[model samples]
Target: METLETTKLDLTGKIDVVENISREDFLEFYMKPQKPVIIKHLYGKDAQVYKWTFDYFQKELGELEVGVFDDESETRQDDRSYKKAPMTMKFGEYLQIIQEKPTSKRLFLFNVFKHKKELLNHFKFPNIADNVLSFLPFAFFGGQGAETRIHRDMDNSCVFLTEIAGYKRVVLFDPKYSKLLYQYPYSTHTSIDVNHPDFDKYPGLAHVQGIDCTIGPGDTIFMPSGWWHHIEYNTAGLGFAIRSLSPHYKDRVVGILQVGLKTHIDDLANKILGSKWFDWKKNKTIERANRAIQKLQKK
Candidate 1:
């Protein structure tokens, strides 16, 4: 495996500041570049909501109505794996649900935008409030020792993931590393094991540089679109995320096509060809990528 150094950029650094910038300044200076920035105190100054922790979530909203789905409901392996894991009842569930047991795996998707408007109002910042429509906030509660598969966001949106409670290990790689990462066909990411990578099986990954960051409460990580990121929650924790599209014309066009057409294509392809089609597409894409790599190496 090719080893690359991981760079750590502090959230408090000047590169990440966006405290009082105007909307035009933000779009021109920061949002356009797709560069990752950590805004310190961007949420607020002396905001008591910052003090809100996982325990508080469990206490205040844990008992709210929840919906559950398990292995039997979804045919996808991702769904099965999550169902097999143990999970507890999530607090204030607005969407879907599936539970297995405690301490295994569980997820609570609190539609904070719909259900907890009061909580959101508490942390509203004037600068962001003016542009609040540009962002969406949701809280995730994962049971201890839960893992989210390595995947990119929909429409290749840029993400700002803020840790509210507990700790999480994040692994990030640039889009150029896609081949080395053994990414899925037509997908933005791979299934390469982060803790125990097999370099010989996937030799191309050696060219990629990955940055590892462990986040705690009040810490935010900015991940650009097309960046491959994998997150693992060490303990039960809550995360707030905002996903936004770039102002770039190309990105906007691609985003619209992805949401409007590509999603339907995926669904149709899956239904018509079944798993065989998925396998064929995946392997063919990998083969093409590998061939491209070989050509590059010849230079």
Candidate 2:
């Protein structure tokens, strides 16, 4: 087994403001800086539905038809109703639920905001009108074990992830860490095991500085666009996220380039070089980076 070494993040004394701020102020300070902020009070605080706990979420949302993946069959089944709903289970029970056979056929929630108006209203940010709130809300139901390979959001859109129930663990890296992440062809991340990384292969990762945060119910994390993040559920968690493109013209242009030029490059690389090519390029990049670092150290 590969031993993993991680630098612990100290968010102690970090600012926590729950007050409502104007749209202009939020965009200028918090959103631009990509700083994480938590607001305890919500807009529909008085709504009965908004008061529903994690247990209630499973009871109501879990019964509905959801999307499921069957790993053995390598197929996706849509709008499948769950039989044994495990919403009230503890963290341990949730882990067991994911480990069930077939590894697929796991019913996962989708577009939850359309079903839960009250919960969606609670996330309403300023300057975003009811009809004009241009985003979707989706939730993953199951253990925190499912891995969403490390990747940055498309178009460098800043993202806000608000947790409603349970806990989520996030590992975030700044834009400068992009090269070290060894983004895959036609995708945004490498196949590196983030928990137990291969330092001998990707030594450049040692120079990357990152911020880690574990969020709980009612906590919101603001991640800037283009910032690479890897998220895992520490427990069965329910949450929705909102993403917005940068308002600046220069940022928007770069975002377009990523989607167009970068994406095209990746597609071509995958077609010509095949899957193994990515691994080969990643190794070469790491080797070059190590040599550069050694030279700098001697200087």
Candidate 3:
């Protein structure tokens, strides 16, 4: 296997860690400011972390059918997080696959509790944020070494992601640096590989600053709305995220447009133009990134 080059960028900014925080303080300090924070005690004492192991899931919800996503792209060279899942399998089989060996298979944006409502009894939702999308609680599962490429959620909502099992390394960038990250046209993600960034090809990445964090079981990380994140599963793990609306109304409007307008437009264009549309977006990403670099130089 080819060794990954050491990352050229330095993420000097720190992701705050707190043992505990009040709902009001979390709002004023972290949420309002759009800062990322890892809360160690957010889940409350009664939360059942031990019961969330892979064996338990496999035993209880094993027969549930699920869409499994992987790091493969058919239309382009870039493997994207938002790519449509290519296959489906029994939830138990996938869990067994990951448990036995490292694999690229990932279970993305699934609500397992929807199939078995009794699963919700394992944990209590934190009351730190308002308008918690209780009905939309989603779960993400990944095997060792599986990576979710750099991307932002299209819904543009604040995400409180709780690590249920194993460990995950996360790299985050504020949305303000979207152009520097070479965000593709009409997409919520960048094709740039954060693990071993090609500085020569994507020079704008060297100028970008970000936060790096690793979370273990029971830790909840607050991801601000529209933040770009790259996630790597250090070990096969499961994470649950409860999303809430962005505090700002304008951001909510953008989220609506992203899902209701931008997604459909991209799909239509891709279907009509095929590979030509991808080529255009790839070239446009470079052009826009160069402009962003030039603007930074002028300042």
Candidate 4:
């Protein structure tokens, strides 16, 4: 971001792309080693692949009261929807807003299989994971230029995300870069926006290594567990994600406590102490990140 030479920077423009990769190769090269890879031509000639358009989504979820990410209310109005107090709207109405133009809100239909099991007939999931979580079949809809915050799944689950429509670019950093990411204590997300980070404030990130991948419809990305990722929807992108646990389960259990229980505690603290709880946590995180950067420079 500071106009440094590309060679000197830790991020590279390339990602491992394979077409119709064998299961053996996936396990040996990417899965076992915990590296990210993109598989091209993974599927074809499927009704779901072609039929999962914006129009189709509207019809299927139309009458349902769906949860929406209210960007302004999340910060300005101090409204916390869907941790317990969710903001609900008609799916058809939200579709209209996104179709018109880009908007602050995002449409996140989590675990659709729970509500409408009939919708599963439209698509097929790949047989890759040893174990896939049942309730985490995520469907995300974002407006043009919308970005998800840089975060790790507190469950420590590996991910296989496929593009259903439009295009998206993902920026990923390995778990080792967590200290450089300005992550709050016991939280799953980083505060700095990866696409347009304030380098002066988060200088440790300058030395962070990351992978950038642009995937279109039908392409799937294998995101290793604990990786930090920020996704940008280049167009009005619709995507689905399936998450799996590592063969080793002990660490993931620890992650659930750190992120799941800790996050609930933080929210409860905020409810009692107000903004001071968040302000103090954010300030402490910044202090830690700044110190790490200074230490890196000294070395």
Candidate 5:
């Protein structure tokens, strides 16, 4: 944000914000069309968005041991969200540390609801869609300046990400820009620092258009399936997402392949080739991005 890369970006693009929406309108205009929108104050009574704070979590779940990940890594596969995190600590201590100052440490895909089921009573799924997958909601916690890299969910599920506390800045791009995003082979990640995009190195970024917005406490964002997102925590914060299967059968099949087949193939290759496999993936991403750039030039 310090260096606004506005020269190439279409600053007019915006994510719709609404206080209320009918099920029919939600489906017709947003969900079916695969567009993103922010719903303000979407929760009911007992909403954690109002009651939960760092102090509240430290007091209640402090003893819980949690996986902690740092922002130092370059390769996404070597340090994936599905894998066990590199470090662990008591949730209370982690909270205490983040409250003190900005750090790279973050909590990803943590199932806090598994330990405290009563928390589920805080929010209900809107009638806008079916198959909410209520049982598998996941929480993401990050300290000030912590960032989740640019990536799409591998399973390609629609995500209802609700910000329970603090503020977060999100930048989203359609999957059509995958090559422009420098997406890695066999992975859902790109190493680009969206905060300070280097158009010189990744020229395709200069050609892509995306929507950017900041969500505060109690705001819920509907992220369509397969959309790429990059998130930055402006303050130490907590948010959770509930996902649903894509309505399209073709997308459902791709989701199955992404989770059940594509990941396995990458794991096998990593075991067989070690560091060389990662090198190959990085080189392949660069090669693909260059091709996309060439195609743009021809236009």
Candidate 6:
């Protein structure tokens, strides 16, 4: 019998981990090349890692309401359903429900800015990321069995997401596999549900390779631009992400436009036109890809 772990094949090999590496080495090997790597010691000799706990957050921002999505990600038909009308709860209230008593309804209720600022003091600027990191960090938190759908991030930027609390399993696919994964017509999210992928419905995913990495407290994983990924919360934990501009200036400019403007416009278009628009785009995408393959084959 096949389990969730064995459902997909992992062929990218293990990601490299470097400890006490120089800035120049990082730039040459990982940053400039835009390959993923795990830096074992992002914080050098700092005892402050112990201070980033749920208890500390509760004490810091008492009674503050944060935006969260309580809906189960797996149950929702579309990824944006939760975002269409967000559910919110107080920070303290969320922490209680998230850890001791978690539900199928996923909760993403962190005070985005407030929590980010407080946690910023924990780590020094990394040479691997350098000044390329954009401001206002992103965080995701949930209990055991919680997960994110298989998808690329909205922005075409490099991401360094660090685990602060419990274990998280990040299953990654190179951007090249997007065609095989059956991506959403107008969104960055893929059509395949990581927890329960319907292989019959998504025949394109056959033989596609994935890479899995599990991170614990104080561990960070670097994800390059457009890398397709799915995240599973193995236990109740808090994770922080810092997205940096792509090394290429053109890529950075494009990312800024897409994240800041294109997403809203696309979402609005999707809403107005509905299923017809989506169906046409999906068919056209497959046709275009097939034509490209045929051209390459004849060459």
**Top candidate by TM-score:** 3
Worst 10 residues of 2 by lDDT: 75-84
List TM-score per model, in order.
0.75, 0.68, 0.93, 0.85, 0.90, 0.84
The number of clashing residue pairs in each candidate reads: 10, 1, 0, 2, 0, 0
Of the candidates numbered 1 and 5, which has the greater lDDT value? 5
List model 3 lDDT by residue over 150-217, tens digit each.
Answer: 88898899998888898999999999999889888778878787877887788888778889889998
Candidate 3 lDDT score at position 131: 80
The Cα error of candidate 4 at residue 150, in Å, is 1.4
Instruction: Write model 1 residue lDDT over 123-160, tens digit each, in one string.
Output: 65435212233336666656555666666565677766
**Pairs with steric clashes in candidate 4:** 82-85, 82-86
Q: Write candidate 5's Cα lDDT for 1-299 as tens digits.
A: 21235445543468999876888888888888889999887665456555778888888899999999886653444324446788899999999888789987899889999988888887777788776787899998989988887788999999999888889998889888998788877777786767676777776777788898999887889898899888888999988999987777787787888899888888898889988888888888779988987887788
Candidate 2 colliding pairs: 144-233
Arranged by TM-score with the best first, the candidates are 3, 5, 4, 6, 1, 2
Off by over 4 Å in 6: 1-7, 45-47, 73-85, 104-118, 288-299
List, residue by residue over 1-31, the lDDT tens digit for candidate 4. Answer: 3332322336674579887677788778887
Q: Per-residue lDDT for 224 in model 2?
A: 68
Each model's C-alpha lDDT? Answer: 0.58, 0.56, 0.83, 0.73, 0.82, 0.68
User: What RMSD, rounded to one decimal, does every model reach?
Assistant: 5.8, 7.4, 3.6, 3.5, 3.3, 3.9
Clashing pairs in 6: none
Whole-model lDDT, model 6:
0.68
Question: Between which residue pairs do clashes occur in model 1?
Answer: 2-206, 67-97, 68-97, 68-98, 69-97, 69-98, 86-101, 86-105, 87-101, 180-205
Query: Which 10-residue window of candidate 6 scores lowest in summed lDDT?
Result: 1-10
lDDT of 2 at 267: 60
By lDDT, the best candidate is: 3
